[model samples]
Target: MQAEPCDQEEPPSVLWGLDPIFSAHARLYVRDILQMKESCQVPGIYFYRFHPIFTVDVLGTVVYRRERDDFFCYGVDDGTGVINCLCWKDEQWKQQNEHVKSAPRSLASSHGGFNPVEQLKKLQQAQRSRSQLEIGDVLRVRGPVQTSVQGQREIMASTYYKVEDPVMAVQISWMLELPQLYRKFYDRCFQMQESDLTDSAQSAPALLGRASGLLKDFLREKAVERFRPYDLLQKLVPLIPDIPPEPSTQQEPTPQSSSKQLHQLLRETLQLLQDEGLVFRKVISQDPVYQVTELDKELHRVTRDIIREDSKREKYAEKGCHVLHVLSAVRQRYCPNVSKVVIEVVLKILECNSEIISTTDSHYIVL
Candidate 1:
């Protein structure tokens, strides 16, 4: 029987490198890795379904070995297939091993007491011995996939070490994890929503308006009170307009260009939302997370109450309550981590809802 053709369209090559999965080391069978498709646009990059992979982690037994001056090449067989792994030697460790071997035997007791430097040298020699592999020994290797001069696919190992799994526990764990990874991430097709494609021809303001509306709808539907940028980025990626290639050059967009466009759109949309009193960040952080203003009902109530009660105070009631006074009161009554920006947003929201009115630019009173 023949396999059915996939209906999903492949995402643009420029977006391939933006995916976090491409940065991680994929755990795949040697046979599958060898058979995977290589990207014509970016050589040395392989794809397993929609997943772009360059590095892989493999656990197998060494079936063959060849020594070089600076590196050792081993044929690793994980039962499915055999692939060559080029493991580089550590020059410092090699030198330490040589020094220990050449040292005089009488040096062991020459001090007639405990010698810390000599003991450290002995430890380094033992580590060097463990790293050296023989045929039939279990080995684990991780590195980027590359094509050798002979046109054979191999791994240029960044890390390689001998495994001592006497009872095969490590192998069994790896066997179980591979299938889960494939089912969850590797096997799935990268697809964009049809609705997003339909809006691709829309203007920039229209696109931002639609994205903001979608985010509002999502928060309402999901009842998300607080969220990080990543939680909403995936939902907005499809809305990013595809820029047409120049007719003169017909050059494809680079990964950096596409990624920058996506982030730029998201940043503009988020800033718009903040200006409209729809969302605010509670704390300044390298990784900023936002809170949906309308979703936090308790904050709105507490903010309104602070203005209502403080407005009636007799400290020359002509000006009502200052923004700073409300901020201090809200911090004590509500969450202490709330920022001045959050209070400003909340005050704007309450004012818009007719729950309060601004007595001055920096003061508010309950209506």
Candidate 2:
């Protein structure tokens, strides 16, 4: 198979031109799904409280398989977490699955040289053949993740494609879909790795683990709502007790045991806490700050009310929303007892961490 080239000299700004009715789904790691909790008010909608959009794109390797006369299920792991994926029978997919399973393996392998046209064709072909994937085969699935009858979360895939390299697939997904603040934090960690620490006595993972422990302890002790990574690291590093010499007579601690090992620990710790739903990056600023995941469900209720109000306004042909209207709705529905100043702070935090966008200072749009 050979892919055709586009005749247009310029690329389209939007792959499919701006149509308010159409929006691309978010791509997420399997770990993302595992971290969510069920919505308190909406009985059937699981974890509807976490993200503004419910649909997601998940990438992972198939670890288990189950097929029925009418449906099929596969367990997939993408480093962080594992999710059970269900694909209900669709005739079109069944046909594609059959074709993919029966196709010769030779067509899937690379030829001598890199051919953009050929590579594109192979990818297209791989899409059709995804249903034939074996254990360990990596795949990227797009669909709405819902809790099954058993209360286990599973993706009802609308479509999926074979991934040639799982590592590259995960890296690409994280780079493209992770929040800007989180991405920058990860990049800084990588840059720190490329520093003189590479020549240190401790391995990178070991240093990361130690640093994560120290940062975690500090966050717990301070009980602050949020703090910059650099500032936290500066304070936390001094408190990290120096490692005792094994012989008790050594002149100095090993390089790995030195405070220099704290390089990426703060961010690494934040990432871990985020995964466990204990903490999250309060992405309301350029420098990523840390915040604890609140236990109260008030924020969730306020968010849902705001979204409901936004939807009602959207039906009126309004292009943007006023922040005051949302804040008023929040106060009326969920926080009648809270102060105006407190409500404003909550809205600003939501604007930063949640998907809501600020069109102007007081106007907004939900992503």
TM-score of every model versus the real structure: 0.48, 0.36
RMSD, model 2, all Cα superposed?
Answer: 19.8
Q: What lDDT would each prediction earn against the true structure? A: 0.77, 0.54
Q: Point out the worst 10-residue segment of candidate 1 by lDDT.
A: 3-12
Q: List model 2 lDDT by residue over 180-216, tens digit each.
A: 6333332122112322332331444435544555555
**For residues 205-324, what per-residue lDDT tens digits would candidate 1 score against the true structure?**
445655666676677679899988878877776664454333135576546776787777788878877775578776768999887887788889999988888777897177878888
On TM-score, the leading prediction is 1
Assess the local accuracy of residue 366 in candidate 1 as a C-alpha lDDT between 0 and 100: 88
Model 1 off-target regions past 4 Å? 1-11, 94-112, 191-367
lDDT of 1 at 53: 87
